[model samples]
Target: MSPRKVSLMSRILVYVLVAIAALYLLLCVALFVFQRALIYFPQPSAYATPDNVLTLPVADANLQVSVRPHDGPKALLYFGGNAEDVSQNLPSFSAAFPDQAIYLLHYRGFGGSSGSPSEEAIARDALDLFDRVYAEHPQVAVVGRSLGTGVAIRLASQRPAARLILVTPYNSLLELGIRQYPMFPVKWLLKDTFDSAKYAAHISVPTLLIAAEHDEVIPRSSTVRLYGQFIQGVASMKVIAGVGHNSISESPEYLKLIGAGL
Candidate 1:
């Protein structure tokens, strides 16, 4: 090839490389800006009525707590998944634990709650709700499912929870994000890295880690890793047979395992 032809080929290669670099930068920016949208999917309350709803006034938001009020010192405080309408569990919880009072929190922007949802904001709300509930019901059991497992574990670490239950929980959201989008730098870009393992070591109460046998969302390895974080005698794990992540609660053993923990 002539010298002029070699020079032209080099110029074309440079241009292609620049275009690829520019597109990669744009993709990273989009992921950073809209990351929260990928995490939280707020839903309306299915049972939002005067009889079932309790309004919790916080500094920046008014959170909704779906309640099954019972007159007892024994109470259950529940935190649900990102996209879950927690009110849907009221009937089942009421039937299973008839003697205990139930309080299922609706994270901000979910189930008629005001303001946006974030890790910091939800943490504050969870602390406030636990304090309020503990004032009335001294023996409070904390139960969290999926996204809420992160919330529940952290709360149990900081508060004096009588019992702790985590359902379909992951070791860390950051790790899951990295697995889902390996091309990106998830460790640096993730703002709400729910590292439940970090909080798991701090937990001292009787705890239950529930896993679905065929969970497609959270890997069994992640659940097992979290279980190992707890002290030798602090936590116990149970896997419900013939269930997926979403369908685990439908199993009869689900409530039984939770009740057994309490």
Candidate 2:
């Protein structure tokens, strides 16, 4: 080929490479800016009434808690999945633990709670909720499911929880994000990396880590890794057979296992 033709080919190749690089950078920026949107899918409460709901006043937001009030020392505080309306769990929790009080948190921006949801914001809210609940109910069990598992574990580590229960839990949201988006720089882009494993080592209370046999959202390997983080004899794990991540609670053994843990 002539030198002029070779030079033309080189120029075309450079243009293509530059365009690819520019597109990749734009994609990364988009991921970084809107990452929280991918993480939290806020849902409206199904059962929000004056009789059952309790308003928790925080620094910036007034959080809503779905409560089944029982005049006793035993209470259960629940943090639910990202998209879950925690109020939905009230009936089942009330039925299962008739003697114990139940309080399911509506994360900020979820279930009529004000302000936006973020890892730091939710963590603060969880701690506040625990403190208030503990004032009345000395024997309080902290229960978290899916995304809330991260919140529960952190709270259990810092507070004097009587019992801790995690359902469909993961080692860390950072690891999960990388697994789902391998091509992206999730570590750098993710704003709210719920690193449950970091807090797991600090937990001293009797804990139960529940895994769904066929959980599609959280890998079994992730759950096993998290289980290993807890001090030996401090935590125990149970796998509910023939159930997916969302459907595990529907199983007969679900409530039985939770009640047994408490």
lDDT of 2 by residue, 1-262 (tens): 9999999999999999999999999999999998888989999999999999999999999999999999989999999998899999999999999989999999999999999999999999999999999999999999999999999999998899999999999999999999999999999899999999999999999999999999999999999999999999999999999999999999999999999999
Candidate 1 has a TM-score of 0.98
TM-score of 2: 0.98
Whole-model lDDT per candidate: 0.95, 0.96
Off by over 4 Å in 2: none
Candidate 1 C-alpha lDDT tens digits along 29-143: 9999899999999999999999999999999999999999988799999999989999999999999999889999999999999999999899999999999999999999999
Write out the backbone clash pairs for model 1: none
